[model samples]
Target chain A: MLRDITLGQYYQADSVIHKLDPRVKLGTTIIFIISLFVFQGAWGYAVAALFLALVIKLSKVPFQFMVKGMKAIVFLLLITVIFNLFLTPGEPLVTVWKLTITKEGLRMAVFLSIRLGFLIIGSSVMTLTTTPNQLTDGLEKMLKPLNKIKVPVHEIAMMMSIALRFIPILMEETDKIMKAQLARCADFESGNLIKKAKSLVPLLVPLFISAFRRANDLAMAMEARCYRGGDNRTKMKPLHYEKRDYIAYAIVACYVILGIAAGKLMPLLVSGIIQLV
Target chain B: MPIILDKVSHVYGQDTAMAVTALKNVSLVIPDGQFIGLIGHTGSGKSTLVQHLNGLMKATSGSIYFNGEDIDAEGFDKKMLRSKVGLVFQYPEHQLFETDVFADVCFGPKNLGLSKKEVELRAYEALKLVGLEDAYFYQSPFDLSGGQKRRVAIAGVLAMKPEVLVLDEPTAGLDPKGRDEILDQISRLKKETGMTVILVSHSMDDVAKYVERIIVMNKGSVMYDDAPREVFRHYQELEQIGLAAPQVTYIMKDLQDHGYDVSDEATTIEKAKEEIKSWFARLSAVGKGR
Candidate 1:
């Protein structure tokens, strides 16, 4: 039952977006997030949406699959929407007993909700197209200059890749332990909050113990293979800036520039047209 | 009453690209108190089949009946079914989490809402049934040896007083002595409690010696379901599917081929020894007559 989670999971598909360098995808995702904050007007949102739609279409990861990741953030999204709707002070649209729904509040809630939703979809698109190992490699390459500042970038990257690799393994272990507990008639469902939390003790203890044991085994296995940090490590598949990666960067940069220009210049152009008319 | 599976099929990740048919139109009836061995190579669907016994997994098509009632029927008590069919997973020692052995064994019965007195009593009995001593009862389960920890885990299930015990490769990581000890205890438990025992293992010799019947699985289907001797008769076919009959079966066949006139049906070492002795007795009798 725990297998349905889609967050940060790579969707296997052969498409132009998936074939692009991971560095390009990572940079695009970061720029997209920044652009979401920069783009304030309707025209700006339209441009951002258009660019996002194009990238998602090219990625070939199904639209439904990308939206599945949004389910995890539904609670956070609701809290943000509620806070914006009730707390913002402006000309009231609707009054309900002690609460007033202001026009500005409604607008802020809608705008912020869209921003959060788009932000999640944008980042998930990158993860869906790129594998964890590739993402780590991209991060390491992008942060290579940090090594001069005494940052252990390579070690940090190695740890991240390993952590990502262990996600599914640990998930499977948890599934097994859960079933084992189930076989003993352990009721994980149909309980109050306290009872439910109490029930998890049996499941979690074994899981934590097994996880530590597995980690120990992994460390020993790595040591046995003479893995002495990434000091002199050579890549089996080194990262390179291909033609497609450069093209992707160009497209993303143009989208960000267009979004910023739309937000900055759209109002002036609208008033200028009104004066001329 | 017997547990019956009628044309049961299970497809993992159904309607997806990665879908796999783990069990295909499988049919079987496990009687009330039979020591049945489920033998299959890896990915042969043995584990999937056993999970269906306790309603741990639902079949994609068809149905399973426990004591003549459909287990998947509306309002059927699944928790009761689980307690009735205790599943001891592979590396069961990993399931032990309670601070002490006795407390760990009590986990199952406690879930059943049993009284404190009865829970402790059942735990005590279960520990004794698995041949774990009283001295170790209060000791930490994590501090015990691998075999002892496994026994405590088994007792955890046993305390529920399940009518059928389904153990999946219980001796997988244990040494030879530990393996035999655990298997012997299971065999003894079956005889003493009259509980239906379904031992899922790929090992031919272990099943041949302990189980009264053997079911061979291949590629998500039952390849053979018969007495140990009858099943072992098709050792060549079993080997073709990445499984083999017990070593003694091959030895008995070899003896017959070498003109010893021994019965090739012997599937276990003890049976093979008796057959070879009888063959010698017959040979000396014929020599005296000549």
Candidate 2:
């Protein structure tokens, strides 16, 4: 039952986005996340939404599959929306006891929620389209400049990719262990908070031990193959910018420009709405 | 029925892009107090079939019944069923997490809400049944040898006192000595306790030697369900699915072809020995009678 988790899961499909250079996709994902903060108006959000939609369409990833990733962040999204919706001070539209629903608060809350949604969905698009190995190569290349500052950029990228690759492996292992424990009459559910926490000890101990064992075996295997950090290591398939990547970059650049223009015009539009009200 | 799978089929990731049919229209009845060996190549759905016996997984298009009761029926406690049909997974030692061997063994009985005394008693008895020494019980299970750790894991399942013990590749990754010891213990446990034991293994010799019945699987369906000799008679068919009867069975069959008067159905080392001895005895007896 624990296998329902889909976080960091890559959907395998061939499409235009999947064909783009990993470095370009990585840069665009960062750009997209940053644009979520830069643009503050409906016009800006509209541009962002269109950009994300077009990417999803080009990636050939099922819309339902991308939305499935959103389910993981539902609780966090609710907390953010609730905190902003009720706590933000603004012109009171309705008052009920200690609670006040304000026009400005409502506006800010909607905008914030929309912003958070786009941020998550946009990055999910990147991950869904790009494989973990590709993402790692992209990250390492982009972070090459950081190496001059004595940062172990290659090591960091290697670690990140290895961790990402192990997520599903560990998850499957967890599912197996859970079944093994269940066969032993281990009651994980239907316990008090303290008891439930205690129940995890049985599950966690073996999981941790196996994880360490696997890590040790992996290290040994790597060493056996003469792996010694990322120094002078060459990739079989290097990431390169192609015609599709340039087209994608151009489209994303246009979206960012439109978002900036919308941010600049937001105040005028809000004022016009206020006059109408 | 001790366990009955009725037209049971399981499709992993059904309707998804990665959809795979692991078990297909597999209907079988497992009688009580019988030792059964399930043999299959990798990805042949033997694992999926055993999981269904305990309701660990729901069949995609059919039903599973334990003791004639529908497992998927509303209010049926699947957890209880799981405890009743204890499954020791492959590399089960990897599931041992308790600090000490004794504590790990007790983990299963404790979950059944047994009294402290009963839990300890069951754990002790289970450990004893697995042929583990009392000296190793209080020590860290991880500190033990691979075989010892395996004993603790098996004890953990046995403590549940399951009626049907489903061991999936229990002897895997063990040294030959450890493998024989574990198999011997399982055989003894089956005889003494009269528990229905389902042994899933790739070792044809072990299955032929121990289990009275063999269920051969290929491509998610049962190909042969018969006595070891009957099943081994179709060694060519088994070989088609990347499986084979014991090497001794092949040897005997070849010897019989070479004009030796011997049965070619021997599927174990001991059985082949007996067959050759019997053939020699028959030759002497015929000469003396003349």
Candidate 3:
């Protein structure tokens, strides 16, 4: 199944990371991704990996559970690695007829793969630890200033949260539809690409129809509840930076500084080892 | 036996925090050509249990045997099983995607790799079995009424000519008349086709009237498996599990408790009427004796 898909999935548990304010967690994830790409050295990535491990442990989300989300992106990961492995021209390391692998290409491939993998895991951690409601509140609060430019921040955040919430519902719907089709002997997994794609006609048409139906129903329900634009709404549980959130923020700051220092010191250390050899 | 579940158990997301054992050690043998009703509250594993019959889901621990062979055994032709035991899901109308009702009904038979002529013959027969008019055949399924759309969806499965038909809450979300019509059609179709029918529903009244055997489920276990009269006798226990017997059962129970000469086994309307008439006869006999 399609239930294996964990898009915007939330795992609830009593832990320091789970208890942190949603805004703080969201900000930390963004900063973490920024630092992941900002620093280019092996030491920075090592520190990043260590930080991710520590966060994963604190969040109480099982490693296996988090890794399952990576299954969906295996193809994308492979494509990115292959592109980086062959496209970057540098001092040649391996050449096989038309395909050339250079030292820089190899290095780029490893780094890019690491970056992408870490990025996914890092974002997954945030989504896993935070509920969609918390995410919506965090996003709205963070984007409050955008309202000065009349950007409809609350509505945008509401739409995002609704979209996030509907993902699992739609996924469940797709599974049901596919099973219904499967019961009809509608094969989806076999045959050539064209044949497989043709098989999807039965599956996709219903999925699309159901998605639209759900959207329409949701719109009607919201309207029936007198949900006009988000003009003057007060939160029942307002977003406030709790004590754990401050602690998380401090830890993230320390991580960024450590990552930057590692990035700066890596060249010197590598050159020193090269000179000694 | 058309289907047999041997202490079957299904666990969703096993070993994870969100793990749920939807079906416990459920062992059941569904005899061929019996109209059985599976009554359970929401999430009572009724859907999961039925899906195992068609090989749509594999049990987490136990095994299911279709015609004496373990369905999970290696090299078992699961697709063939799926075709043989057609499952019409809840809100099956959502699966309707073909431009017209005729083509939609043809989908299952066409997927069965049947020739065009045979597929059409089966489709037409199925539509007729569901009591749809021939005029509705060429119309878009989307253009049909809710009840008609549901009938078309059922016809799609019927076209497969399944030996065992499993319907999951087929009449859910329909008006009372629509519900009755669908149930009546299903009952008629069962009698006509003699397919081993398993109706999964929460409605005691509906199942009590239509099915010969009723299987009552609660919390992933079959609490009662017997004739509707036998199952409804324990209305108190059924009520405890967020389910109720037909209204007539409680009414008869009330009469019985109040020292009336009414039988509490009147689980259906027709049976209740007979119980009342017989009780009136007994009353007149007592008057004559006095």
Candidate number achieving the greatest DockQ relative to the actual structure: 1
**Model 2: reference contacts kept, as a fraction:** 0.84
Candidate 1 lDDT tens digits, B1-290: 58999999999988765689999999999999999999999999999999999999999999999999999999999999999999999998888888888999999999999999999999999999999988998999989999999999999999999999999999998999999999999999999999999999999988899998999999999999999989988989999999988898888888778877888988788888898889889989999999
The native-contact fractions of the candidates, in order shown, are 0.84, 0.84, 0.84
Ranking by DockQ: 1, 3, 2
After aligning candidate 2 to the native by TM-score, how far in Å is the CA of A96 from where it should be? 4.8
Query: Which tens-of-lDDT digit does each residue in A85-181 have in candidate 2?
Result: 7788988888889888788878888988888788878888888888899999998998889988999998999899889988888888889988888
Candidates 1 and 3: which is better by DockQ?
Answer: 1
Q: On lDDT, who's better, 2 or 3?
A: 3
Q: Chain A TM-score of each model, in the order shown?
A: 0.96, 0.93, 0.89
TM-score of the A chain in candidate 1?
Answer: 0.96
Task: Compose the digit string of candidate 3's lDDT tens values, residues B1-290.
Answer: 47889999999988766799899899988989999999999999999989889999989988899999999999999878988998999999999999999999999999888899999999999999999998998998989999999999999999999999999999899999999999999999999989999999999988999899999888888899999899988888998999999999989988989999787887788999998999899899999999
Q: TM-scores of all models?
A: 0.95, 0.94, 0.92
Model 2 chain B weakest 10-residue run by lDDT = B10-19
CAPRI grade, predicted model 1? high
Alpha-carbon DockQ of candidate 3: 0.81
Question: What is the CAPRI rating of model 3's predicted complex?
Answer: high
Q: Candidates 2 and 3: which is better by DockQ?
A: 3
Note the Cα lDDT for every prediction shown: 0.93, 0.88, 0.91
